[model samples]
Target: MVQSQTHTFEGKTIDEAIEEAKRALNAEMDEIDIRVIDHGNQKRFPFGRSRAKIAVSLTESNDETWETWLDNEIEDQDLFDIPLSPDEKQPVNTAGTAWIIDGQLHFHQTAEKKPILVIPYDGEVYNHNEKLSGRHVLKENDVIDFHLETTLIETKWTVKVNDKEQTVTLTVTPGKKIIPYIADHPAASVIEPIVQFDEQVNNQLQTKDVYEQLANMEVIEGIDDAAIHRACSAGEEQTVTIASGKLPKDGKNGEMAFRIDIQERSLPYKEKHDGTADFRESLYIPSVEHGEVLAEVIDPLPGEDGISVFGDVLQAKDGKPVIIKAGSGIEIDEEQSAVIAAQSGRPLIEQSGLLFRMSILPKKRHPGDLSIKHGNIRFIGDVEITGDVNEGMTVEAEGNVQMQKNVMHSTIQSRQNILIHGNAIVSAITAGQNQAVYDALQDIVPISSPRTDLLSP
Candidate 1:
């Protein structure tokens, strides 16, 4: 037979056109030269349908002699016109795929360009009682079957019911399905086989299978069917919750929010522009005017009950009530649920367990030396010491601290200002007590040197 040196073919896609060329030339992929004339447009179809076209020719290295062509009378035949024997046809390694969309079969690939799949030719696959073959989109409820056979894929999973019996979860390691096909042989590529994968469970799990698992675990309440379906079809390793239970919400505790510095009763220091402590700047003293509101009371709330998947009721705790008492220069406003100052001085709070007392003092005077007889003086108002403070004596005041005589081997702390008219000998005196305490804390951890771990036991 005398065949043309080159020929052109058209198909739905470039791969299909090449497959046709290979069969016409009776040659392998390497034995031919192919030029893509046109890549078919799947879109803009019907009115402007474009089919993929390719030009194929045998390579110069082809030197095969046709055994029966010389004896035949056929001559000058086109490449496609030449008749092909069963043995002469080459294998075509292409196949079509199918998917279920909106409860209907879709023969073509999805928009995501997933691989085209072909259902294996089996008696099980049917479209309304008729055996199906090739690519065909069927209506809903149409069964799609194919033999999935493989041994290399691995799948493992575990179903866990939470200790509270409030949830059910599945931890799965999905497996893969490998479907083999032959290219040139048109028959094998068309009829895809369907078989069950040899594993603990197939990666392609059904929603019903998951529903059965949840039923076995006795998770009847709040069973999320959608979540179970998504997990079954994910075909990847993941932990998914198939059921859930409501949780109990605890009540809020009662609280008292102070608007002023009644807890610490300290003065705040000023900082320089360069972020350094400016000791020259006077610290701001925290004091309340008469009738100023000190704190607001927050009411407690009752908690809500919850239910478990096993139909068990979970009880919740109620919040506790808060109380506030007025001390010297302070009054409680029951109508506003607030603590108000009766006289202006310095606000203070004394706590004994859950009970709280709010107070304010104007000043405290000392007649003589601060010795063992006088004991240590701790006042929220200004303090005036007439005589010297002996060794081991301590004096702390939220307002100004004035010393008339010498202080020796003693400690004096004032939140606002410290005025010493007499000499302070071997004494530790702090004007801004809060700032001094903060500075002392910083010195405890030296960043520039190897330091010991104070927290280590």
Candidate 2:
């Protein structure tokens, strides 16, 4: 058994220490485990300075395995009975308050060192015989004289209007309730001792206060009373939608309607019970007869106007029109509002911005042989192959397919009739897109040589 080796290294930084360790041990980073011992501090000038230290230990031999190392290093512990510090250990920092209510003054202290409550400029308070001036702190059993204010802490609210003046939101800052003393007190008294008086937070806001604020802001069009009432009931610090503006609906753009069956031709493969689907079935090219309607042009619709909570008028949008023009092999019927095919050929559509250009190509002709270098051939119009169709090449046409030479190890299919004046050897060919004809053709023996008279069809 080879024993593990351990060493210590120090440098200005952790990366420098690891690099020094790696150079000294002549080992890569993954071959050993690194443990940081002390992260040294570097102070200004020469006052305090220390180097970073790391302990690099060689990993256990490959034979020991990770499970064995884990079993040797880790031990089970009793974690259920862990003890916690007592709550009395926590420090306390609390202050006291004082207030006056119901023609009487009171003061209460919560800690050893109580704060002195000073009389503000708006307060009408007096210290018995001599009227108190400036700041005055009342003590226990001290005599004080003051006028009886009817409502000490009244409900306060405010209204916020959006920048666009489209919405008005109401925010209510709840007031505190003046809790009168529980002890016996004389009514309309001249002097009362500062003994018992307290106050509690009152979250309930008044609706009348909100309405007065809204009226001041001139927001009366789309005010929601229920939302304001709910806000008043909840009373916490929150913003609610008191008024909302009606949003404008944009107009629908003009569209073109084409034949549904032609668009639905190219579909995804359907999975069979055997868990296999043929990709060729998903490929289809649609063809139209002469004078067949291709697309119907529809006009654009206009948009509606909207109104804001501030009674401002919002303008409506007018829908734009789509322009259409006919190219070769296509014609537009103005009376029927449709685009018709002029000849029995493939229909081609090209779109640029809002303009749609429709045309049709008569046929697609190949001057050379169909091979791997030329790739597969798929066209919407009839195909005319002048040369041979090579191995692994496929030809698919929407209309008729006419081959002049030989077809070897290839697939040729067409939606219409197929005329091949070539020798087909180990190749699949279908005429009129009939499944039964393709199946019967697959069973026929492959012809090796050119049999012009026997194979030509």
- TM-score against truth, every candidate: 0.42, 0.46
Best by lDDT: 2
**Which segments of candidate 1 are over 4 A away from where they belong?**
1-66, 69-156, 163-166, 175-201, 263-281, 323-330, 342-344, 350-357, 364-382, 385-403, 406-457
Single out the weakest 10-residue window by summed lDDT for candidate 1. 448-457
Whose TM-score is greatest here?
Answer: 2
Per-residue alpha-carbon lDDT of model 2 for 1-457, expressed as tens digits? 2436779999888999999998998888877788999777888965577889999977644433533443333224311121234855532212233434444444433324333545444445667666675655555456766532434565566677774647888776666766543233321112232334576657667788778877777666778999999889764566788987765666876766765233213457657579886443453334455677777877888988877776666777877777877888888888988778887555566666567777766576777787755556565558888999888778876678899998999898877878889899898887686765444433321222211111001
Model 2: CA > 4 A from native: 1-156, 163-165, 178-220, 229-234, 260-282, 364-380, 384-388, 391-406, 409-457
- Give the lDDT of residue 255 in candidate 2: 63
